[model samples]
Target: MEQRKIPFVIRPRALGNAILVLVIGVLGLVMAHHPMLFSGFRRIQTDLRDTRLIHYLLEHGYLWVCGIPEHRTFWNPPIFYPVSNTAAYSDLLLSVGPVYWLWRAGGASPDLALAGWMISMSAVNYAAALVLFRKGLGFTWLPSASAGFLVAFGAPRVNQISHQQLLPCFYVLMTVFALARLFGGNPQRFWERGGLWLLAVLGGVLQFYSGFYLAWFLMLGIGFAVAAAILLPPCRTVFLEVVQRDLWVILTAGLVGVLLLLPLLNHYLPVARYLARRQYLPMYYAFNPHLWSWFHVGGNHWLWGWTAGREPFRTLGYPPEHLLGFGFITPLAGAAGLYFCRERPICRLAAAVTLSMWLATTFLPGKAIALVASGVAYYCLACLFREFNGPRERAFGLASVLALLVLVSFPNIYLQILTLSALMLCSLELVRTRGRPECQVVPGIALGLFCLKVFSLDVLLIGVCLVAPAAALIAYYWVGRRRDVGLGAVLLVVFFTAVTTILDSPNVYLGALAASSSALLVSAPRRLRPPAWLSVRALIVAMVLVVWFYDQDSLWLSFYNKIPGGIGIRAVGRIVLILLIPAALGLAALVQSLEQKQWTLAAWIVVLVCMLEQGVTTESFDAAANRATIAGVARQVTPGREAFYYRPWPNPGWNTYHLDAMWASLVTGVPTINGYSGYNPPGWDGFFAVDAQSTLDPRDVLAQWERAHGLPPERIQSIGLDRTCEGPQQTRHRP
Candidate 1:
């Protein structure tokens, strides 16, 4: 037998770094070349006004004040008793807590400030991934890091989730990661050494911040965890022992996190009260008393929309894209992941339970998996891949299974062919590696494909197999077996491309920073001059805001119609790009890995998934309008005694293409209604369904609300407007 050395080009660590550079660079380049935020995903951008509120809350210590431009300065209102609305405050916490201080300390620009917030989220998410793989999945550097890729950059759909909602996804996914890792394998690593105690505390703490979504995923994850644990030789002992002994510790973690954070959270209870007072009637959803078909939805509908008079799309199966989702790209690979469940007993049960639930939720006529359960379910299934290796030399056998499944499930020829090819590659690789679950080249590739759904078009995902493998093989030959050198060269090129892109697209990023050495580029503002409309002090303060970072559709009519470009660029295109982040990262890693002469197998999977994400949404420049509205409203408000209304708050709020006047209150720490809080009363969805309405007479609803809460009208007056109005007099306007 000839013992052939295929070569060890890119080692694990270097491969990862290289791929990171490549992915980031690619995005950077795109950012530079076509720099309009609204070019494709106009609605996804932030409203500077709301962002200002985040800064304001951090700086002013919750002394609510409207920076109403009419008054020309921050001022108190005519009303007496203050209304403590918790909803706005809750929204603020989600946006401001993590990056508020950093923004202020750094003296950053709006763009930089926002970018900093995003970076923080990615970092926390990355940490969570580390915990899962290093500690839970028990994989080495490659697989462990892959968890972060899966969470932060893995699935393309993440981009479509509002920037704020990403936090919910982040925290919840973290807890589940701990669940899978802590309880999945090597229980002694955590439970024996206070790991169970750690998990309990982490779970509790995250669950508090994570909200309803955490609860949902917890139900699903626990069941899945139970299955995973049951399969384990040591799970019973660990689960029982940990649950019995460390339950309090875990509970305390949540209690303590909330307890400590509540003071800050309470700082804005008035805002929540404000949210609760209003209603959020959406169009897409309604309790179908007569027909369940009206509620029929695809698996991806974890979003809310302002309903018009139209009956919910009449359907029993998922909407077209959704029905196609399970069959996206490589149905075979997804099927393979599902089929692998049978190879291992516990694996089968967990897979069956999780995937079945995920499938049901996806196809369920409601928002079952929209929160975080869907994401957790997908990843948990990924972990059930113990069958790709071990006693079953069934890589080809299973690969055949996946191919056949894809043929049956998917009806789209382009996607079917593209996905089938990718799956086949993955299937073949599994055979070569003897099904060692550790090899990630194909899955990583698949992960890359999966990520494209966030912001780019799916059709590009097909480019992965073409671009990555070709580039990787070429790099390997040039660099020999040294993964470091190969990846370094590729990384340099990728970074240069990203930097150049950013430089070119002045509208997208500070090209100067990317073009220059990162060391020389500071995220904070270098100057402190009060330039135009802003006061010198305000300028200085704005320059020095401690950054803290980082919604759904509502009422999307307000969103789609109001976009800045007036609806030209493909909204789905934007989604595709952001969604591609994970896959891009993974593919870059693969390419970078091969450049460095490393061995990885699943790069193809990322490629396949990315291909499928393109067809998922209707991308457009609406994202620009959405973000513009957010930023625009922040600049419009002049703090003073003048009353205001978010007449068109959450509808546009959920998917901001352009920042509107509303942002000032939130950023400057003033009170605001109809921000991103879900505190709107129970009948909100129904309200929107009856009419494509943005305005409601606050007078009509106010008395009812105050009476219910046992509060006076003065309290509502002190906060702001009685009802969100779509009139000229409204201070914080949404329309």
Candidate 2:
């Protein structure tokens, strides 16, 4: 009469708890980023003057497919008239189409429907992460909630609220969870295993329909995980065993996924072929994450707004892609999880080699001597630390390092002695605790030194002070646990400081060093324990680190760009969305492992800091103006008439009249030649240039387009020029 527990199943209470947390989180996010909605739902979250409008039009295309009055076919949206299959010009949005339709059918205004859809997507993302942590990974409520909050509404993600297509990331977590359930365990029943495989495939297909960027990055992340599993010794047997046992299930699921994706591929292949592949220089400049980017939250962030107009951020080509900040707490918590988790030596070695290659490629030649000298000095210090066993010896070593740090950093002789004396006393007091590990003091010392060296007493140092301790504490904890981990952690800090010192800037080198060092420690030999890499914890750490590295324009991305579909992916930074999966898991693991009350308190403080850091200011479009403009255009472009919209002035940008023209077509079921999307039709550039110069009449522009596309003269029925929407416009017909 005992109840049998099911794997990867959420109990009712856990489900309830997750739902409650998700609701609160979603409401908080709405308040922070979309407060205008409370005044009137019509005011959607958008600047109303960016390429984001195209996403709005794309979602509206789904409403057109649902029996809305539209003269054009579903695939050929009314915009970019005469260009067939125009909906395929960007993400299909097929997965969220039904949801949009339902929201509209329930009598929500277009703007309201779009806003509701975005909020719902964010909610779904949160719920999925909660389920993944609580059920799939067996985490308790606090960590699960914390991780779910981070994945769904992290600082960087909050900056991307306008990118609705990127909002619905539930499938990313779902696919990862499915893979974990399918391969990480041995299920006795064939159907259960098959279902998991099917779930993974379904997740992939949904992601493809959601956004091309998400789909491409999801596959890339999966490939990384699978490669790690296969290459690392600990995970190899289990990975191979699953493949050997469930070859049919895996193959069948894959085939099914391909079949589901074929229709989308057919629509997108031509578009991809027509569009020029992204070049290296532009991609590296615009899409690649610079070292400062990892810490650069957007200008609108609540706590970090002041840092927005600073050095590198001002010079970054694409500001959105540079908003890579994941806050200090979550990553440090993740690093802590990595330190505690066991992993394969080969995995660590591979990661180290990869980092070495990156450092070799990017390191400045002039500073090589400095890097070497610092590295050697750090190595010697680490060796000395290893030999110390008592509190006094540890205190003396830490004090000496502090004094040297203070003296070297400050130029004034009196200031140097005073600062050095204060730091020495603090270091002595930090290590004076009997029974407590001296390594625990390392984080405090590191925090003070980093703040003093980097910012002096600047207010911005608050974030750094809060963040540095988490990293130092985590690294110190690793040192306390094992001799090799201690050495690796120390070397990692030294190498990181050396790189920053030599480059005269902070970059992703620290991340690379931490990842490589963690990997090395994971691979270190363990007695009687299974390979740490085989554990769920190790998988989470490895996947997070790999995704982080790949997002920073690693060599893997360069290799990926050579393959089909890879060259088309310009926004490589978007791949950071995948990090939410491992980040959530890592956070949950860190919270669960905290046994001391003080550590628990520190964790909470870190969480609060993260929330403030992630908080964003919302922007809303003037929905009334947009609605009036579209309606005015719709009145001018009647049924049975394809409109040609031309601006006498040079076309300012895609978001201006072009957006209105597209909206008019969607509303009136009229096709318009003016359109904006990821790519233009074959002859759009030349036609647009000629029209923008005002050399050709509106009719001449339509005629030029028709002639280029080999269309009949009768195809152009009306011309919607600059003032056409205000009054009567003459019908243009070619003789």
Best by lDDT: 2
lDDT of 2 by residue, 1-735 (tens): 999997897789978875768665765567445655575665667666543454555456565666665533567776777778887877767786677677877897777777777777777787888787777666677777777888888876767666667777888888877876775546779999999999999999999987887888778766666676676667778888888999999999999999999989889888877764424565554666666666677777777777889887777658887787766655666656545543633223224332333332221232333333333323323332333344444344445555555444333222222233333233333344324655546635653664356343444344445445665677667656454444334334433433444354223334334333433344343342232222323323322333223224354344545666776666666666766566556666666666234487866665566555567776777778778866766666656754555342334454566776777766776667777776677777755575446465555666677878776666565544443444334334445
Best TM-score among the predictions, by candidate number: 2
TM-score of 2: 0.67
In the range 484-602, model 1's lDDT, one tens digit per residue, is 44433333433333334334444323322221222122212325212222222222221111110002222222233343221211121122222222222233333234324443445
lDDT for residue 666 in candidate 2, whole number 0-100? 67
Clashing residue pair totals per candidate (backbone < 3 A)? 182, 7
Candidate 2, residue 514: lDDT: 38
Q: Model 2: residues >4 Å from true position, as ranges?
A: 1-24, 49-61, 68-72, 276-284, 342-557, 595-600, 648-652, 687-701, 712-735
Model 1 CA lDDT for position 251: 72
